[model samples]
Target: MARWPLVPATDAPKNRDPEPPEGEAFPVTSTGLASEQPLRSAAFRWFLAGQSISLAGSAMSPVALAFGVLEVTDSAAWLSAVTTAALVPMVATLLLGGGISDRYRRDIVLRLTSLGAGLTQVGVAILLLTHQHPALLLPLSALNGIFQGLTTPALRGIVSNLAAGRGLQQASSLVASARNATRILGPTTAGLLTASVGGGWAIAADAASFLLAAAFFARMSLPNLPPRTENGPTMLGELREGWSYFSSKPWIWTVTFAFGVFNALNMGVWQILGPVIANETIGAEGWGLVLSARGVGSLLASVVMVKLTVRRPMVPALSSMTLGAVPLILLGVGATTLWLAAAAFVAGVVSEFFTVVWETVWYTHVPERMLSRVGAHDEFWSFVPIPIGQLSTPVLAAAFGTAAVAVTGGGVAAVAMLMPLLVPSLRRIEIKRGGD
Candidate 1:
């Protein structure tokens, strides 16, 4: 968020303001101030309020959607199809979305996408309420994905802008905490709504949240960006530029690649086999409790991170990620529910810790102008392996048995997380203090 100028002030365009106006939401600065608090900024407070509400709604919609699908046709295959419809478009459009964010006002991009997403959700609610054909969900889900892709990159950039230089870590931590807390509340809310009013009402609530968040975004006052010159790079050229910058940074690309491997293996085992193992040992209710424990742990970590600062973050960040493999290992070994919950809790804490630190590092080091495009690349690569894991895990578990697959996947994920440490550049990265 440090608008640490990429070029000197003397070389900046005359139209550009070196600092934010007196009443702007994010006051620009060259370096972070440790005493600054994110919540004190009216802009950040509004942003957080909107994001927290939207995240809660987002978390609820999935549960409602799943139940709605099952009610219509108790076919797991149809559910998978609906999920895939959303995933494919989201992954496919990420880079293009990132490029668009870089060329425009990130807040405006976010506002438009949120509006689109809300409208799509409204359509989904209508379809569910009408008991329409399940096939209709495919198009609706695909539209949701397109909106999601367009929104994500801009989200990262906007958070940085909201807090700017001084309160980035606190901002990231607060946002993450809201997300973690919502993960616990959202599903429970969805269950209640699905039982009483039906899935359509729950989804309708999600649509309202999106619309409200869009309104908050519209009200934010951000510094004006320089107008895009007619001779500026084309979208394709801009994408190439983003890729060039992303690939050129060893710390950036290597950590992202490592996360790709880690996410693929970890998601495969934890998402697919964890439930299977839980069903065999613990009941469905117990499995839910285990997940709830993890969410609680993540929330605690985010609170801790508000005051915690790491000078050299990557070392600890990567180191703690190894904890992510613990729950898988416990599940593979047929641990009791209590044991599994304990492992999951610890894993969640470390995982959230890594997330907070990672965002802080990016906000501190990356140039604000290119943050969205670069983040898009980072998100794109990290997400690309998810489907591979989701698809292959069940097949592997069937062939090798769930226990063996879970254990092997856990081992592989741990190694994948640690492998980035081997890169000297990654290991040596430190927070850029005082605009270094």
Candidate 2:
């Protein structure tokens, strides 16, 4: 692994135009069309339209799947078992997906994956509707995961492909806002569909959404990507290449590692201990309100980020994340429901700001050729520790008490999240307009 310089500077190649002074807005092109014209691009519009449609259906799957499983087995353990089957494959193949995405046209990768995923979902829906053998669920679920694993990295990279250069921020913010809106709409629609019709129908709806997304991808044009340079490369070789790039970049791996630790602590405490605390302190209904408020905050953040500009994006990226622990602190201290909810809402707002800035910076800074692979590694590391956190938090809470656990995790998470700021490579990454 390469060590970073102590001074704040980028490890990547210097831009032709020097970075503007700290706190100055990024140097936009004279035309400003890179930022302005992305929305007008037919390709970007189609990409957004496809994602919007797919996300809406994908969102509904969680509720529908849960209920669908219940209709078959009526066991929470089975629910966990089947869902884990899906997740394992998805996580296992993420890096491979990234490599493939980089090797081919992203639009083609997305199209195939979307079609595969849609067909798998449709199969799962049929099995569920017909009340097939419960044993089939796990295998079907794993098949679903396989498609998801193949899809995700390709999907993540496509935004950069569709909206390059200065338009990235605006493109990202628009997609982010659409995704946030769907988070509310998807589940609501699923709930109504599940109640009025059946979980099977709701799942079928999700499958249909995937098919529509695939159709959109099939029709849309993508930028001409470079031909694959490494002929007859092995999968392992390509993966190693991606990993080499990922680990060599201090900013990339440092932030990724920070997220891993923060998510471990934060997710563990939140998912495992949160509901228990709410039961005792705020009551489940109040907790629901708090969660709803958080979602609303996320929606509002997407809107705010559309107009927001950051010169040194990492400043706000890391700074915004520090606020995430506030709600945990309040929860641990036994704050009232309204207070806790208010804190959660603020945390959600800041988290979205971090998200928008982080994505913008990643695409802005990383080499385009390696974007998918680097993104996959970034996601893999960040996600790998979540289960560990979720599993261990309970044991720790049992020993130290929930309040102590929550406080300790929140404090630790806050410190870990901010640690990347000390790294020179990360601290000075600039997001500027012009030049691909």
Candidate 3:
């Protein structure tokens, strides 16, 4: 293991890079298509291991929770309510969570939040197993959401620390690949556990995964990041600082805005409606296969992204997002399992590609000290509409018909995908090396 010596804020050298000229687009740079494997270091390996364990658990959660809710009451509406309950707090806490990550040791924050999430799930499992009122699960789920929200910014912040300037793209690709691989395994395991033992046991397994992740994270020897240069008077003040930093970069904010709507229409719509369609048209088994195909697509794309490089990354990132609408449209049209699966596979690939490009852009261009807060802003803007979309999609679909809603959402997503390209700054982005 490489020793990470703690450097005090007073001793650390200040960043020497000149800030981009005001009232102009930030200059884009990249590592320019390096095919080297990710750095093999103890800290990086431990961090990756922790993330894999945690993500596997997270992947199982939705399936277990959804089926558990259904077991309690066969109403799709109740399921939505439970999912929304978690999302609301997760979104709400994100800004503050980002600030906290920037202000503290990110790994510690992640450790604590992971522990909280695990315990919260365990509590829910106990409640469910005891045959207590299922309504109790809602508040526990909300508590879990709060921890989930806090985890993101810290995780983002810590990744660069672990990478140690080796290659952010390679690191990001490996992490994405782990997540995608887990998506294939986790849900399938959850389905089996739910069937064989019950939803409670499946959820209990998720709790154990989080505990294991926490243990792995505890072994890391992460470097101490420099303290914030501009400490705000309060949490809100810190958030405003993050916002100022985020908004100053025109390309970043523009893309963030587009994702806000895109996520709403695509992610939100899928979560709310995908299961409904699967239950009605495709059998549950078929839906599982479709989702597995999507995971496979993502896993394959992550592999491609490990080697793929673009001179102008935003072109692919923005253009590829339009593909997200395909599966949604296919589902609305009541397409065959094969057709829906194909479209879903494509959508997943596009989504993963964009994720690599976007993360690489931030890790490369943004100041390391402020990356967590900026990430929070990025996350906040993009995620704000997700819950709204989840809650409202069904209502809108009911009034307008599923086909109309799907097509309209797809149209909006396409527009969002193209709309960012109109910005002169977005069009001009280029990548040289991540964490440059």
Worst 10 residues of 1 by lDDT: 21-30
Pairs clashing within candidate 1: none
Task: Give one digit per residue, the lDDT tens place, for model 3 in 1-436.
Answer: 2222234667543432345432222332222222223456666787889999999999998888888778877878888877888988998998889989877777788888989999999998897677677778899889999998999999876766655333667788899999999989998899999999888888999999998898888887555644555633466766777777788767788889898999899875677788887788887878888887888999999988877877678887889889878888877888888988898899889989999888876776676667789999899899888778877999998998887888788888888888888876666665664444
User: How well does each candidate superpose onto the true structure, as a TM-score?
Assistant: 0.91, 0.89, 0.87
Model 1 regions more than 4 Å off: 1-35, 432-436
lDDT of 1: 0.82
Candidate 2 has an lDDT of 0.80
Cα RMSD to native, each candidate?
5.2, 4.7, 6.5
Q: What TM-score would candidate 1 get against the native? A: 0.91
Q: Lowest summed lDDT over 10 consecutive residues: which window, candidate 3? A: 24-33
Candidate 3 positional error at 367, Å = 0.9
Q: List the residue pairs that clash in candidate 2.
A: none
TM-score of 3: 0.87
Order the numbered candidates by lDDT, best leading: 1, 2, 3
lDDT at residue 412 of model 3 (Cα atoms): 87
| Pairwise TM-score winner, candidates 2 and 3 | 2
Candidates' C-alpha lDDT: 0.82, 0.80, 0.79
